[model samples]
Target: MSITAATGVPVIEPASVPVLELKGIGKQFGAIRALHGVDLTVRAGEVIGLMGDNGAGKSTLVRIIAGNFPPSQGTIRFDGREVHFHRPVDSRAVGIEVVYQDLALANNLTAAANVFLGRELKRSFGPIRLLDHRAMETRALELFQELRSETRPHDLVKDMSGGQRQAVAIARTRLSNAKLVMMDEPTAAISVRQVEQVLGLIHRLKEQGIAVMLISHRMPDIFAVCDRVVVMRRGEKRADKPIAESSPEEVTALITGAKEAA
Candidate 1:
């Protein structure tokens, strides 16, 4: 299926096969089991918020999905094909982009340079080719404008505000043609206004038909943008329900394993 935007751009819906699927996933560290029998599905154009307290296996699960760690047992499928992401680059190859809590921007690099950090466009000059700074800056500006962000390509990362920095990180993800964008506590240290800006960017990602997996503990943030919420407790999925069908209190209880199905 496909959706047409108000601007008449045809946004292709995620394939019938989920963009990302984890079935009976399990991960262990030494004698400790970080995650066990956890299953997740992320579809195109939908935002799924993952909620759990610290040590609830949110980090382990994300690491497994992002290819930072391999699962001990389970099957992961992307776009209908079984995939084993042995490294971060492997994950990126399949259009899976992860934005960690740190936002990973180079403090000294300009916004455009950071956006194309490792994937720089270069003019062909055999082995002596130089970086195409002009092209990168132009493209970065276009992407920011497309997302309706106000940040400029020439801005220094260290000089920008929190929200602007977040926008730049998100723009970098878009540059990779990411089909699934996973955000880990994207609004953690920002001001209220910055939080709003980041949330708006999440919506824009959905508008572009990208599948988003959001990891956050903030109930208001989750409820504001997520179509569905998945609660995890003791490294297991406790419940998956539509945001509107569940109350914050009920979800919190589920996360803490304080309530069972009535």
Candidate 2:
């Protein structure tokens, strides 16, 4: 704690606060309700696995958090301050980043080019500015090294494997110093070794005090990296607990509605 300048009162550091918090979150689309009474909390350096079947409101909830849309009713607090996001940029401005299932990379571009796609570095010698390829490649190399990935900065993304592509996307997030990262099915169609690579990257993010929310249907992936599991069914949250206290069988039952909320 630190003393406040004016009142001389102690102030708690932000490290003690939760990174993301949702209270009574709900969403509706016309006559249909996509989510209802969902509450969640994520702390720094924690990984949460969000699992559910189709139409379980998983996508809807993610969209809301990503600022694709706003919740019909709820309070979203980030770093202990309530915020309302009207657009995706708003969320990104607050250190929230999302990596969709597609991995959204320009296959025609090199790893370094892709990493600096929209926010490319530039240098000026007079009135003209040129793209700083060397600087970008150097920074991209550093990011790949930080993640312990073997991806080469100058390699074409189209020639890279699924795991390497993931590294490029994740490297972009690192460039933003993102506080929360929401990953959608990162290991969907990768080889066993590649899956391990991705999981290792997740571990690296946690080690750096970044909060991760992994949305995946693969049981093993979730069990492998998540500190806690949250299951959604029929637009409502069915279970939220530590990974050790829950089993795959129980989660399956929850998703299928064979068992009620736990």
Candidate 3:
């Protein structure tokens, strides 16, 4: 920890540990070996940029971590304990959340509805129970405010911009108190302004001490928000370096095989 010279205020690093650890993680679909000996660790509040070319096993590794499938070999340790996840729920049960590119939102629904889609708030009236619209709207409003987003709770998702949709999706993760969030192609095809908003939201998550794994092909987005960059090529990790020590040129080379490994 260091103190500011001018203000004499102490700066404390956020306490962190390896929230997710993958050791010798591998996968195979029949005879096709999709991943081999891939090891990774994401600590609390760390933002990792995962970049690679198409068919570079990025998706396969993410799917394995997301519990879409079990690894063919190796073990996954979450919060310092070994875990074997058979399905997505098992991962979610342990505070893992994924925000896919599609956002998986109900277009016709309000932002509040989308935020609490599967985990809706309920109100009981003696023998009757109903969806708690007022409570949900109140909570969703608070979440949007926490993210510093202008998205209104009652606004229909279809009428919202790409960035607002992202806000709602991220709010859901916050609602779940997710320890780690893996976002797949979050900034893809979004406008420049919207991209900035999404990056700001990522910063907010970091400030709140949530680990984020951002999977994207966009180099600027990675450099702008990530603390570290992990590169993969042909189903193997090629580089894992601090973002300050790795340039886009180096990452591009690692992805395309111009440079072997780092």
Candidate 4:
């Protein structure tokens, strides 16, 4: 099936049997239609890049997948089964975690505390509930080591570098056994060095057999880490193709809705 972007929309190819599939997905807000007949699929062990210009419905789509908003019309399927996600918690229960561009981290909290923020370990002492600080710290350190992350569990998030904070976020998601991680412009606010580190982390995520949906406008990064590219335009899917099959120029044309001469 093909997804065409409207007026200013891009044209992207479609993938096969995505681990996550949105069939004829759509969302409407009063008189404004945010999305229409959009279909998408993400497969395991693949980094699918979702590219689009501003107002291209990328955020809307991510929100829908992340369960921030339910689609007004369409069916969402995960692992070949139809599923309804009413909230972010529902998405998490199904192993879908989203890391927004903001890299939501509590600056005042230590790395360990930030990583295990909501799901902290606890101990029971004869009717008294106690936070298991030691256990949490130990597991946080272990998780960092497993990811080859250099940040210390005791490091204050405010004192850590941008990349370090990013690492903490990713580690937290992994700790929750996330099967699919959606990163929105993960490299947006970091230094060049940190961008490299994040790219390496993305590759590592795939190696661990976790599917990733990366939303970025950086063509080089897309070509570098993503196995396939899915472009969106004007609230619609434009193209979804293997990285090797399409060139940067071709993809750009798709995004801008510039048709090639016959």
- Identify the candidate with maximal lDDT: 2
Question: Which order, best to worst by lDDT?
Answer: 2, 3, 1, 4
- Lowest summed lDDT across 10 adjacent residues in model 4 is found at 1-10
lDDT of 2 by residue, 72-168 (tens): 9999999999999999999999999999999889999999999998999999989999999999999999999999999999999999988899999
Q: Please, what are the lDDT tens digits per residue for candidate 4 over residues 154-224? A: 99999987788888999899878898999989988689998888888888789888999999988889999
Give per-model CA RMSD: 5.4, 3.5, 4.3, 9.1
Each model's C-alpha lDDT?
A: 0.90, 0.95, 0.94, 0.87
lDDT of 3 by residue, 3-67 (tens): 98999999997655599999999888899988999999999999999999998999998888888
Give the lDDT of residue 192 in candidate 2.
96
Is 1 or 3 the stronger prediction by TM-score? 3
Global CA lDDT computed for model 3 = 0.94
On TM-score, the stronger of 3 and 4 is 3
Error of 2 at 113 (Å): 0.6
**What would you estimate as the lDDT of candidate 2?**
0.95
**Best of the two (1, 2) by TM-score:** 2
lDDT of 2 at 27: 97
Provide the lDDT at 188 for model 3. 89
Model 4: pairs clashing at backbone N, Cα or C within 3 Å? 11-238, 11-239, 12-238, 12-239, 12-240, 13-239, 13-240
Misplaced by over 4 Å in model 4 are 1-18, 260-262
